[model samples]
Structure formats: structure tokens, C-alpha cells
Target chain A: MRALDVDYMLGLLPILLGYVPLTLFMAVVGMAFALVLAALMAVERVVRIPVLDIFVRLFISFFRGTPLLVQLFLFYFGLPQMLSFLTTINGVTATIMGLTLHFSAYMAESIRAAILGVDRAQWEASLAVGMTQAQMMRRIILPQAARVAAPTLVNYFIDMVKSTSLAFTLGVTELMGAAQKEAAGSFLYFEAFLVVATIYWIMVEALSFGQRRLETFLNKAHAR
Target chain B: MISVQNLNKSFGATPVLQDISLDIQPGERVVVIGPSGTGKSTLLRCLNFLDTPDSGKITIGDLSVDAAHASRADILGLRRRTGFVFQNYALFANKTARQNITEALVTVKGMSRADADARADTILRETGLEARADAYPASLSGGQQQRVGIGRAMALDAELLLFDEPTSALDPEWVGEVLDLMRKLAESRQTMLIVTHEMQFAREIADRILFMDDGRIAEEGPPADLLDTPRDPRTRAFLRRVG
Candidate 1:
């Protein structure tokens, strides 16, 4: 509104950069948790393990069908009131939990499709060779599924980094939080928000570049 | 020896294999020829417990499993004694030809890496896939991939090999190479149950050719008798069309 404060935007860039590590940490850690949980859910869905399959389906449907912000509040605000042990949950913990559960719901579908994408013959061949179900999954299915799911997972991770901005609503002073506080102090909301957006854009662009390189590397053997 | 008793399998209401029973003496090369959808592949799959039977008994070596009571351990044990080569060459896409051969050796057989690598090398040489050892399935031609599939199966040294239409997916040019390798295995007296459309190859290599129809063995005997002499009308009709 007040002439778009270019100088203020330039000055605030480094200050915001200071929070990049924490932002990256939340996204990375959230992704790690999400990857493991998603794989289990995907496998369960594929294997269709009696009652457990239905439970996993419901969890995935609920988390995936709902918004990340509501899930965060459910973890941070609603969960503690429902369970005494969850009283230990705080802003950062709540953010991580929300990110993990919410994103896992989406990632599970991707991983499941990837697992199914592997030729059916591979499973029969692995079984014929006397591989246990666990062995088949570890040595064959999961590895191939990882290759198929990698690009999509990387995209999710980039979205996750941007999604950490929502964590500011939970009282964690991550990058966006830092930006908000700076804007409040300097009364230059436009410039502060613009600086934060630019940083996020650069980070996403770098990840996109890495995604291409990784895809090329993964597909090199198949490339004629 | 392998013995199957009263093996029955169905998909929903449609019967794929009905009360099928047979025996294979050690080192007997049994080739099964039948029309598509007649359950020839299903029969081979059931022997290895790949397609769990609705009601049956399968015994390979000392391991035996019955359809009604087959446990996971029993299925695993039976599978350990047999190898399967899929029509599409089912070599692991992520692994190299050598690794595909070595995977079962190291993981299922619990062989040390050195031993597995040695076994893989021997099999690769046997299948004439040595030059393609490091190549992945997608990079190799169909013949080479199927050779890798056979090598992977042979590396396990399973008591029996079950081949489900091994050459069906190959191009015409590649089919002969695969048939030649299979001929070599037969010459070495590897016990095998093969389902194939290559009637000529079946006639040459089979100790007994089982002509299947409607999920049952319509006729079976010495390869020469089955191929040359008159038999069941169904068998005659099938041979007339394919031979």
C-alpha cells in the first residue's frame, strides 16, 4: 500500500533466510515420517488385511479429504482435550504430526499405485523363488515402487516446504512467522510478504531442478 | 518326484482346473500342450503353489501341501523346491541380469554373496547371458530377458522348473534362441513341466506330452505315440490345428 517498500524488502531477505533451516527441517522430518507411514498404509491397502484394511482406508480417506489446517488444529487443540497424554503436544510437534498424517494419506495412494504399476509377473517370480512376503516387498516391490514414486514424493516435499507457512498459525516462529513479526514491526507487510514468497519460489525452483536431475539418473538404465 | 492329487481350482463360479492329478518321475521332462484358457498354465502354477488350489494335494521332493490346510510355511517349502519362468520374462526390472540370478540364491537359499555371485556367473554362462550380466531387463531384447529369466530360475537349482509359456512373449526371431537354450536344459535332464505352444519343440523334448482339454489331460504318452498316433478326438482336433 505505501509505495511497495523495495529497500525494506531487500533488507528483510537475510533475516528471513535465517529461518530457512528450521523450515527445511520441518519439511524433511515430516516427509520422513510420512514416507514410512504411507508405505505401511499402502501395503496394507494392497494386501487387504481383514479389518485393518478398512481402518487404514478410513484414515486415508479422512486425512486426505480434509484440509491440512483443520488437521493441524485437531492435533494441536482438539487432541489434547480428548487425550490427557497429548497435552505434551506443542506448536512444532503438532505441525509435524499434522503434516505427517495429512501428507501420508496422499502419499500412500501414490505409493500404492506405484506398487501396483510394477508388473504382476515380478510378484509371481519373486514368490516362485521362495521369497517370503516380507522379503519380496523389501527386495523387489518397494525398491521399484520407490523409483516410480520418487518424482511425485519430491513434489509433495516441495509442497510441504511451502505448507510449513501454515505452522505460523500454531505459534511456531518459522520463516513465515519470522516474516509476520518483521512486517508488524516495520509496518511493511507487503514487502515482508513479498520477500517470503520470493524465498519460497527459489527453494521450489531448486527442488524442481533436482527432481529433473534425479529422474534422469533413475531412468538412465531404461533410456535407449 | 512330484505328485499332484485331486487338484481343483476355480475363479468365482468358473472352474479353471478340475480334480487334476498327475505324477512326474525325477528328471522327466513333461511338456503340456493345450489351447489357451484350457488351464495348462494354471496346472503348472498350482504345482508350485503360485495359484492356491481349491482342493488338492501337491508333493515335491519331501515337502507336501494340501489345498484345504496348506500353511504359509508349507507353500514356501514347496516353492523352494521349484522355480518358475514367466512368459513375459518377469526378471526384476530394478535388478541387473546377474543380480536377478543372484537374488534368490542369496536371499532364499541363504548363500553367501561370493557363492551367489559364483552361481550367478555359472548360470549366466549357461544361458549365454554373460555379456548382458549387468544389463537390466528393459534394456535387453526379449530373448536376452527370457534367458535371464531362465538363468534366474536355474540359479536356485530347484528340484523342478515350471515354465508357463516361456516363449510366448518373444518375437519370432527370438523364439528359436530360447527354444535352443531350453533344449540344452532338457539335454542335461533337468526335470521340468513346461506349458508351450511350440508343438515341434514339445514333440522333441518331452518325455511325455500331456495334451490338455477342458482342464483335464485328454491324452498323454510317449512323445512319439502322442504326436504320431491317433488318440482322443479332442487331442486329434487340437493337434490337427496346431501341428
Candidate 2:
């Protein structure tokens, strides 16, 4: 076995860092899309709208039941084969679509629970004031629900960042893909993989710090 | 004036409110007293269509709704004519005291922000919550939060006010302050319907007392008649237990 090359690993660090933005971009954009979609799904689940509720339940079950990797393949490979219109979707787009849809299913349940977790009294109070359903939701319910859902959302974003590694399978040269290419050329898998792992660990640590800060801010009024 | 007729509500097989009917002249203060689960709260909630009775007709001023056929617009109009104070206060936990009072003014009544702010300030002062106007409900004492709840309801200037166990959640020391504020409302002759366990406060403030038992109005009379003279054995038993 070749001795681990320290210089080769250090040289590969910048190349790996170069791809961090793409990975972060995918996670951030995917998170934004997923949050909005999840909120809509959550509202649908809560309201139990006639035909739409059935569709939302099936969608959530399917996405949450399947693995992200398989979903990515379905979006990137299978869908293109079945639908000619989807042929233009590249690996990055496919990965984002998969990430958004899959993670939205999970986030929707969290958001629904958070919304439901708001005191029933709050709903009564808003309605007692003559607020329409939309006004009550916009002015009262969703704000409190958003605070309850924020920490979980941050955790999901962190998970999404880590999951971006799977994008390399779709031929997208994100952080993991860049590290893999460098490791293959240098013939030093251990060193290259260790660098990528440390970077991911540091990123998650940063998010955990942010999560703590957010919780404190949200809890400030309730805090003694 | 407010009137409810044949108000019936049930949860599955359990009837919560049964054939409840009552009338309140303008500015009458009516207090409902009953054991927990007797549907006193359910009755007040149905007046505002909050509980959505299985079958009933509610009339407030010019607006009326039949529970079985109540359109959304009718429910909205009925609610707009009445104010409800929840048992737990239920001031928006995320909003400051002032915002909680002003939210409905701007959103429902179409008041300008400045006018709403002014009205909120005046109501906060009236409730002795001016000093705590900027505080969130979570940070306020239970009495203070209930005062905000009262203030929010009062600011609406609705034709009638409904309160559900307003002081039940307050500490003993805090209960006196809330009752004091409510006493002031009674003295001012606000048309109010209140559900509470505070028998003394109810007797002191109510123009009439309604003793609800087992989802029906078992007995009702003027405060002195109902509290001092007992006609129904159930009412006598309930009073003895709570007294």
C-alpha cells in the first residue's frame, strides 16, 4: 500500500473547497423550495381538502418511503427515458428536484406537527377577533408555527448538505465528486476522503451552533 | 340583543349542548355556572359559532346563523358581532400585548394602523396594562395575560362579549385583579355572557345566573334567587359542592 501523501491531500483541499459552493447552493436552494412546498403540503394535510388531501398523502408516503438515491435516479434517468420533455434536465437539476421532493415529505410532517402544536387557544382567540381563516393563519398561527419548526428545518438543511454527496452518482461534480476525482488521480483514497469528511463535520458544527442560537432567540420570551 | 334557540351540539355520541335556548337584552350581564363538561363553555362558543352546534339558530343584532345551514359568510358576520374571551386568555403568544389588541382592528375592522394603535393604547390603559403593552404574552403574568385577552375583546366594540372561565387559570392572588377588572365592565353594563367557577364574582356581577347541568339549563334566575334560593336538587348539590 502507498504511504498516505500529506502534500497531495493538502493540494486537493482547495480543489475540494472549490466545489463547496455548488454543494451549499444545491442544499440552500433545495431547502428554500422544500420549505415552501412542505408548508403547502402541511396545510393541505391539516385542512383535509377533499381530493387534494389524498394526493398529498400519497406523495408524502412515496417520497418518504423511498431512498433519496433511487429518487434521484428516477428523476435523472428513468423520467427522461419515459418522458421526452424531461430529456433536457441535467444532473444538477435532477439532484435538486429529487432533494426538494424527498425532503419536503419529511419536513411537511414536522411543519404539520409544529402547526398543530400551537395552542388551540390561539386559534380560538384569532377567530374570536373576527379574523378570517387566511388572516388568522397569516397573522397568528404560521408565525408561531414557523418558530417551532425553525430548528428542525435547520437540521434538515444540514442533512441535505450531507446528502449532496449522493449527487456524484448523477455525474455532478459537487464536493464529494471533486474529492473522488482527486483521490482517483492521486491514488490516495484515505487522505482525500478524510479531508472531505472533516469539511462536512465542520459545516455541521457550524449549523449546530446556528441551531442553538436560533432556539435561544425563539425561546427568549418563554425563557426565565 | 342576542338570542339562541334549539342550540344542540355533540361530540360523537356524547351530547355537549342540548336544546339550549336563551335571550339577553342589550347590556345584560349573564353568568353561566356549571361543573366541568356541562357545556357552559360550549354554549358560549356556539353563540359565536366557535363550536358549530349540530343544530341551532343564533341571532346577534341584525346577523343570524342557523348551525345546520350556516354559510361561511353568516358565521363570519356573526363572529364579527361578538367577542370571545378564552379560558386560558389565549392572547397571541408571539405578539406583544398591544399587537394582540390591535391585530383584529386592522385585519378585520379595516381600521388604519394609526387608529388601531391609538385604540390599542387607550384600551391597554383602561385595562391597566399600559406598562406591559410591549411585553409578549409568555412574559406576562396569568392575570396580565387575561387582562390583555379582555382588552383585545373590548377593543373590537362588538355587540356582545363572551368569556369562558376567565379566571380559572389564574393564581389565587391574580384572580382578584381579573375579577376587579371584570367588575368594572359589569358596572359599566357591558352586554356580557361569562362561564366561570367564581360563584362569588358571578353573583356580584351577573344580572342573571344560569345554572347548567348535563348539557341543559337546569335552573336560571336573578343572581339572588339562584344563589340564595334553590329550586332544583341538582343546582342545590352543585352549589353545595362548589360553595
Find the candidate with the highest TM-score and give its number: 1
Judge candidate 1 at residue B30 and give its lDDT: 97
The lDDT of each candidate is 0.91, 0.90
Docking class of 2: medium
Candidate 2 per-residue lDDT over residues B194-228, each given as its tens digit: 99998888888899999999999999999899999
Candidate 1 - CAPRI tier? medium
> Ten consecutive residues with minimal summed lDDT in candidate 2 chain B?
B44-53
Model 2 interface root-mean-square deviation: 1.3
The parts of candidate 1 lying over 4 Å away from their true place are A1-4
Against the true two-chain complex, what DockQ does each candidate achieve? Answer: 0.72, 0.60
DockQ of 2: 0.60
TM-score of chain A of each: 0.95, 0.95
